[model samples]
Target: MPKVDAETIVHSIAAETNTPEETVARIYADALDTYRADARVLDYVPLFAARKVRATLRQNSAKPH
Candidate 1:
């Protein structure tokens, strides 16, 4: 797993989802905590949910022709 940094994660999520960094930061906070992988890597469904959010957004953005 990639090490999660507040700035890096926020930037990445924003870039990937075309969302604001602040929103991603909030999502991170609601999803995890100080350091996303700080100590709860295998005890929650947040990580999956975050990825799902991004994936869904990406899918929605992709036009079907």
Candidate 2:
């Protein structure tokens, strides 16, 4: 797999989810940290982190304000 760039991921996620880049960046960082903690294979960390952050943003949006 090609190397993933965090900035690209952050921008893509922010655009797709209609979220702010700053917010996405913060969440992506946290998600990356969480996944990195127990990841045995480092190659998929960015993919996993991006998925997790996207899911989290979606879930949060679904919740009642």
lDDT leader: 2
lDDT per residue, candidate 1, 1-65, as tens digits? 65445577668878878888887777666655443556555544455646755765577669686
Clash list (residue pairs), candidate 1: none
The lDDT per prediction is 0.65, 0.96
Query: Where does model 1 exceed 4 Å of error?
Result: 1-3, 33-65
Q: What is the per-residue lDDT of model 2 for residues 1-65, given as tens digits with 9 covering 90 to 100?
A: 89899999999999999999999999999999999999899999999999999999999999999
Instruction: Estimate the TM-score for candidate 1.
Output: 0.50
Runs in model 2 deviating more than 4 A are none
TM-score per prediction, in order, is 0.50, 0.94
Superposed Cα deviation of residue 64, candidate 1 (Å): 15
